[model samples]
Target: MKNCSNFTNDVVYSIIISFISVSCIYGQIPVENDTIEDIEDFDIIDMESTLVEEKKDSISWVSDVFSAMRLGIQYGFTYKAEKPDKIMNNRFSFRLEYSKSFLEYLSVHIDTKMFTFLKNDHRIRDEEDIVALEGRTREAYLQTSFNKTSIKAGIQIVVWGESDYAIVTNEIGRLDYREPLSLNMDDLRIGQPMLTIDQYSSFGYWSAFFVPYSEFNEQPRKGTGYYYDPFDGKVEYLKEKQKGNFSEYGLRWRKTFGKSDISIMAASLIDNQYALRMVNPDLITKSKQRFFMTGVTFNRAINNLLVKGEVAIKSEKAYNDASFQIVKKNALDASLGVDYSPNSTFTLSIEAVNYHIMDWSDQIQGIPRNNYIALLALSKQLMKNNLSLSWASMYNGPYTNFFNVLSASYNWNDHITLNFDALIPIVDDARSGFYPYRDQKQVAFRVLYQL
Candidate 1:
C-alpha cells in the first residue's frame, strides 16, 4: 500500500500538471467558431436555429464534421508480480479516430491504434512484428438511413449485452486477450466484419446482422508474456475448419416498457473462443465450434437503485476431456446486477452470476460443473468528476478465488487525462479459473490527450 500510494501521488501530481499545461496551451490557440454568422440576438431559440442551419448547410446528419477527430497517446509499464527478470511490460500506444456525416443517408467513421513496447515485448515475433500497429479498422464503418430502417456495414465492434463488463449475452464479436488483467473492459473487444440492419417501430426495434467472415480471438504466441503460452518459442495456433460458411446471422428485438429496457437476441455463428484439441510435436493448436445462442436482457430503475439482468443459452460449447477428445456441450449463463447511487459522486453495484451445463459428461473434467460468482463494484467521483476512483472485485464461488481491480482517473481538462490501475488476485495455489498469472500482480499508468 505504501509503494502504491507513493506511486499514485507522484504520478498524479506530475501527469496532472503536465497534461493541464499542454491542454491550456492548445486551448489558448485562436480558433474561431465554425458556424459563425451574423445573428440578431443571443436568445436560446436563435442559437438553436443557428445550430440547425449549420447542420443543414454543411453536414446533413451532424452539426460539425471537424469535431469528429479524436487523438490520444498513452504509456504504461507492467510485469510479473513475483520474482521477475528485467522490465518486460513497458508499452506505448497511440490512437486516432475520425467520423463524418456526408449526406442525409450516409455517414462514415474510422478508428485505429498502434502499440510500441520498449523492452521485453512479448507480442513481437522477430523484427517484423516489433512495435506492431493494430486495430487498423478499429471501427471503420458506413451507415445509411432510409425511412424507418437504418443499415451499417463494414468492420465494427458489436456489443449486445446490458452488463457493464464480463458480458454474458454478447456473443457476436471476438475478444482480444493480449493484455490480460486490464482495467478498461471496452479495450478488450475486437471488431469483426458485419452488416447490420435495423427497423424502428412503435412496438420496438428489430435488428439483424450478417457476419460472413469467421476468425477466433487472437492469443499470445509462444514467446508472449501471457502465462498461457508455454514459452517454447513455438506458435499457438488454431486448427482449420472443414469449411467456411457465409450464412451466419443474428437477430435482436428491443423495446422500452415504462422505465425498463428489455431486449431479446439470437444468433447462429461460429464461436470465437477456442478449446485445445490436439497437440503436435512443434505446435499447440485449438479448434473453433459453431453455436446457437439466445439471450434476454433487461434494465430498470426503482427508487435510487438500478437493476440489470441477462440470461444466455448456448447450444454448443467446446471443451476437452482427460482423453484429449473435444467434447461439445450445451451451457446456460445468467447475471443479475443492481446499482445504487446513494449520492451524486458515489455509486455501488452488486452482481451475481450463475452458469450451468444442460448435460454434463463425466469425461469432462476440465470444465467446471457449475459456477456462482459475485461481483462488487464501487466508484466515486471528486472535483466534479475531474478526479475519479473505482474499485471492483469478483469472487468465484466454487474455487474461492478473487479478482480485484482498483483504478484512479484524473481529467486534467477536457482534452487530457491520466489513469492508474492495479490488478490483484487471490486464489488457491492449485490451478483454477484464472489460475495462470494469478501471482502476476500488475500496476499500470497512462496519460492521454484527446480532442
Candidate 2:
C-alpha cells in the first residue's frame, strides 16, 4: 500500500516538474510584431460571424500560450435547515499553460492545474466539499495545425452532447448531499491524455476524441464480503486490493442549418480486471466490462422563440453470475423555452424540461425504477450587466413534490463577483423523500475573484 502511494506521488511530482520546465522555456519566447498588431485589432464580436476568418485569426500559438497564466479564488458560506448549522469553505486554484509555434504548420500546447483548500468546515464533509483538491496535474498536451484539425495528448477534458443544466457523461462532479445541495465545481474527472480531431466549416463544427484506459486515483474500493446484522440490514466496507485500468472513447458530430443546430454523440468504456470486479462482479471473469451510451440534441430558434431537447440510451453488462445479461436503460429529456426582450434593460425568459429514466429488470432494485422532473426559471438584469436576479423551481415527480432556488449576483468588476443561492422545498412526501437533500431549506453566499 505504501509503495503504491509512493509511486502515485512520484508520478504526480514528475508531471509537475515537466510542466514547469516547458512553461518556462516557452514563456521566454519573444512575441512578434505582426502577432501583436493582429491581437490589438482583433474584434471578438465580428469574429463570431466569420467562421473561417475567425478560425484563422484565433489559431495563434503565442497568444494562447501566454493566456495560460491564470489564477482564481472562491469562498462561500452555507446554512442548512435540518442541522441549523453554518459552514464555510474556501479554495484557490491556479494554472500555467504554454503554447509554441513549432512550425507554421504545427503547434504544441501544454497546461497544468494546481489547487488548494483554503478553509475547512465540518458541516460539509470532505468528500462533498466543492473546494477540495484530489491531486495536481503535471501536463496536458495539444498538437494543432493552422487548419481546424488537431490532436491532443496528456490530461484534458472533453465535453459533448447538450443538456441545459446537467450532462450524462462520465466527466461529472460528485454531488454534495450533506447539505442536500448540488454544487458543481468543474472538478470532476481528472485530465486524461486524448487524441482529438476538429473541423470547422460554414455550416457548423465537428469533433472526435479518444482516451486510453486509465484508473481514477480517488475511486473507492469495496471489501471482499458483505456482513448482515440484526439491526442493520447490510454493511459494506473497503478492502485494500490492486487497482485496475480503464479506457474510454467517443465520437461526436454537429451541424447547423440557419437558426437550428443538431448534434449526435456516442461513447463507450473498457474496464480491466480490478475495476471490473469492483463495478461489475459478473464481468470479472469475462476479461473486460463494457459500458455504452448514445445521445442526440437539437436546438432551434424561430423568430424570438428557442426550443431545445435531448434524448439518450445507456447500457451496461451485469457483473454477477449472470454476467451475460446486458441491462439496457433509456433516458428521455426535452425542454422548450422562449426569451422575450422588452426594451434593452428588461428581459424575461421561461423554460421547462421533462427527464425520465426507464427502469431496468426487477433484479436491479435500489435505484428508482422510473422518475420525472420539471423545471421553471426566471431572470432579470438590473443596472445593465452589473447586477442580476434569478429564480428556479424544480419538481421531481411522485417522491418529492418540488425544489425551489433563488439566486442573485453582483459583479463588482470584470474580475470579481459576489453571489447568493437559496434552496427551498415546496412539498414533502414520505415515500418520495428528498434524494439530493435531507432538509427542507438551505442557503449559500459566495465570492469569486479571477485573474
Candidate 3:
C-alpha cells in the first residue's frame, strides 16, 4: 500500500479540532459560582441569591442560542442479504444545521454533513482506503427581505415541482444517486451556488435564480454495488466531457387560489445525469448536454384528498444510440399523483409518470420511446406518533424493473431515534435495461442522536 501516513495524521487532527470546537461552542457555557456559606451567614446568602438570579438569566440566553443550532450524529450499518458475513456499509456521520437572525429582516442558514468510514469496502478507492473522511456543505446561504421581496445568495437546494414521486420539472439542482434505494429525498439533494430573488405581487409570486456554474449528479463509484458498467469492468474508462463549468438560470411564477396552488417554470441548463458515448471499443466516456426546459405544476386540496400534476418538455435532450453515439432529441415528461389521508396518522399516495421521446426511433438504446412508471406508497404513524412505518414501491412498465422499500422508525426519546430498512430491487428483463444492481438486496439499521 502506498504511504499515506501524513495525510492520515492530518485527518485525525482535523477531526479532533472540529469536535472540540463544536463542544466548546454549543455544548455548554460555564458559569463561575461563589463559595458556599454556612447558615449563620445571612449576608452571604443574600448575595448568593443575587448571583443565582444572574445565572438564571445567563442560562436562558444559552438555551435560546441552543434552540437556533442543531446537531445530528448518526451511525449506520448495512448487511448484504446474500452474504451475511460481508458488510455493505459501516459508517458514521455528523450533520449540523443552524439558523440565526441579525437585523429584523436579515437571516443566515447553514447545513453540513461529515462522514467517516468504520469498515473497509471496495466502494472507496485506495487514496480513501481506510477511515475515509468526507464532508459536504449542503446549504449555506444569507437571506434578506424588504417589503414583499426577498433575496438569497449562496449554496442552496431548490425543488421546483409538485410531483413527489417523479422529477418532472424539478431538474434545477444536482442530486446524489449513489444509494438511491437507501437515501431519503432530502439526502439525495446536492446544493449548488446560486443567487435567487422572489417578489410577491397582487397577481402572483415571481422567482428567479442564476447559477454561475452548475454541477452534475454524483454517481456511484466504480466497484460499488450499484455502480453500472456495461463492459463488466473489462474496459479502460476515459475522462467524461463537459461535466462542469456551465451556467444554469431559471424563472418561476407561482400563485395560490383558495384550495389550489399552481406554478410555471422555465430554465436553460445542463442535464445533471450524463450519457455514455463510446470513444473507442475499449474506452467509454460520459458527456453532459445542454437543453431548454419549461414546465407547469399544480396541486389541489379537497377535504381528505389531494391531487397533484406536472408537465414538462425538454428541447434537444441528449441520449446514446444503439451504435454508442450521442444523439439529441426532444422529450416530454408528465406525472399525476393523488394522496388520500383520512386522518393525521395514515396516508396513501399513488402516482403515474411517463417520459416520451418525440419522433421516436428504434435506434435509441438508453431509453424506451414511451417509458412509463408507477409509484405507490403507504405510511402510518403508531405508538402515539413516536413510531412511523412506510412502504414504497416503484415499477417500470416497459423494462419490468422495480424497487421496493420497507422502513420503520422509532423515536426512542427526545434526542435519539432508531431506524430499520429493507431495500429490494428486481430486474426481470435482462435485455431491456441495466441489471447490475439487482443483486444489491440488503437490510440496513441506523441510530441517530440529535441535539
lDDT of 3 by residue, 54-101 (tens): 656766776777789999999998887864346777899999999988
Task: Output the number of the TM-score-best candidate.
Answer: 3
Q: What digit string (tens of lDDT, one per residue) describes model 2 on residues 27-135?
A: 4443666453344334322333354344345455435655755555666665555565444334454655565666676666655666555445432234445444534
- Name the regions of candidate 1 deviating beyond 4 angstroms: 1-65, 79-81, 125-136, 230-238, 244-247, 279-285
Give each model a TM-score: 0.80, 0.63, 0.84
Candidate rank order under TM-score: 3, 1, 2
Q: After superposition, how far is residue 282 of candidate 3 from its true place, in Å?
A: 3.0
TM-score of 3: 0.84
**Residue 275 lDDT, candidate 2, scale 0-100:** 26
Model 1: clashing residue pairs? Answer: none
lDDT of each: 0.76, 0.55, 0.83
Q: Which candidate has the highest lDDT of all? A: 3
| Cα lDDT over the full model 3 | 0.83
lDDT of 1 by residue, 1-451 (tens): 6467557655755675556455544544433662212121233345446555653564443335557777788776665556563445677788878877776789988887887776466665554554654444468889998899989998888778877766688878787777766645688877778899999999998989998777667666556677474444565566655666635788999999988999999999787877666575555566667889999999998988999999999987887787566788999999999999988899999988888877887888756678788989999999988999999998886767898999999999888899888888887845466778667677767788775
